[model samples]
Target: MASKDLAMGMTFLTQTVTGILANVVLLFHYFSLCFTGYRLRPTDLIAEHLTIANTVIMLSKGVSQTVQAFGVKYFSQITRCTVLLYVYRVARGVSVSTTCLLSVFQTVKISPMSSRWKQLKAKLPKHIGLSVFLCWSLNMLVNCIFPFYSINKYSSKNTTKIKYFRYCSSGFPDKITEALYAAFVLFPEVSCSGIMIWSSSSMIFILHRHKQQVQHIRRTNVSHKSSPESRATQSVLVLVCSFVCFYTLSSCFYASVVNFSIPSWWLLNTSALISTCFPAVSPFVLMSCNSTASRLWFKFSGFVRRR
Candidate 1:
């Protein structure tokens, strides 16, 4: 392999390995909490699903890209390409949906407890599982078209409709079918992004107002630290901002690829790398921001040090 290809392969390999490990640790922590008789918060439940989706993206997209970058003929078959493409698309959609859900849930969580808010707050936790289930089911249904359109890279050379990727290719449909598919895919993504922006803005406003109200009291009380809600809000804000930044860049790269009649190999690699950034970084974000995860990490580190 060329030096550039080697570097890109290593980058992808590092990202995939790191992301998978971080997500595994987080997932195991959550499951351990459950087994230890700890009741998981609703946000924890949503986060677990996000971790799973991120892991899937790492495996299906990140690992494949890495293998292909290193000059391996992975996903050389039509069936393998189809299955991986389907799974990656579904997982990518679910990641967006779950992140939007997390932001909205946190916004409602920290809102002032009015009667309307009270009812929502009371009912929201009960439905978190259902919400996550719907995210998975809807994404799966929407991305079912992938299997029909996916082709191996070698097969793409015979067809005029093929859109090139690093390891696999996507068969573009007729104009009407393409428009319909784009609509189904873009609508949910746009809606989720809008929700995330609105929720993040609401959270910022709420946090600012609370800070102002408590400023004098905090100054007077030496021991007063930030509240749990405040910490959680800050974490969600960071999560939302990071997700939006990475997702937007990824979308732009993806758009560039789609716009070109034949996208360059570097463009393909750049798009794939940008697409995996959020997934690779998000677990560490959660681990650092979440007190429970932080504590668990510290304990684990200390235990390792003793050994």
Candidate 2:
């Protein structure tokens, strides 16, 4: 491999491994809590689902791209190309959808009793499982076209017609067909983005009101420490901000892949890195916000030290 390719491969491997481990630690934390007879909170349930989706996303997209960087020809078969791409797209969509659900759920939880979203707070928990299931199913079905469109790595005869990646190429969709497919693929993403914006905005409004109330009462209260609600809101706000940033970058990269002829390896590497970042970073953010996660982290650290 070229020096730059080697460097990119190493970086990709490091990011992928770190993301995988972070998510595993979170899953272990949640399961340990359950094993100790602690009832899982609704947020905990969402975190669990998010962690699993992140793990799948990292493995599917990150590992594949990393291996490709090393010039390994794993996606030579049409079936393999389709399957890998399908899994990556589906997992990516689920990650976005789950984050949207998480943001909306958090907003509803903190809404005032008379607020319209408060009506959803009660029903959210009951439907969370089903909602997650539907998200997976919907993405799976929508991205099913990937396999049909993915060209085998060894199929060079048709490369001139389609946009080819290092190991696989996308099917040539005529202008109208491509536009329609793009719209179809983007519907969930657009919906998720809209939900995140509305939820995060409402959360900011609520937090602002809450701070005003705290200001009025600060003179009488001895402690000015942040409440759990405040901490959680901060964490979720960070999640929203990070997702928006990363998701926008990823989307730009995707657009560039279509619009820019002869895209560079650096662009590809950057896209992969941006796509994996949220899954890698989100578990740590959740861990910081939850007491149980923190205790579990200390316990795990002690166990590691002893070993």
Top candidate when judged by lDDT against the true structure? 1
Error of 2 at 143 (Å): 1.6
- Give a tens-digit lDDT track for model 1, residues 75-131: 556645777778899999999999999999999888889635778987898999999
Candidate 2 residues 187-220, lDDT tens each? 8898899889999999999999878867978878
**Residue pairs that clash (backbone atoms under 3 angstroms), model 1:** none
TM-score of 1: 0.92
> Lowest summed lDDT over 10 consecutive residues: which window, candidate 2?
152-161
lDDT of each: 0.84, 0.81
Pick out the ten consecutive residues of candidate 1 with the lowest summed lDDT: 151-160
Residue 264's C-alpha lDDT in candidate 1? 94
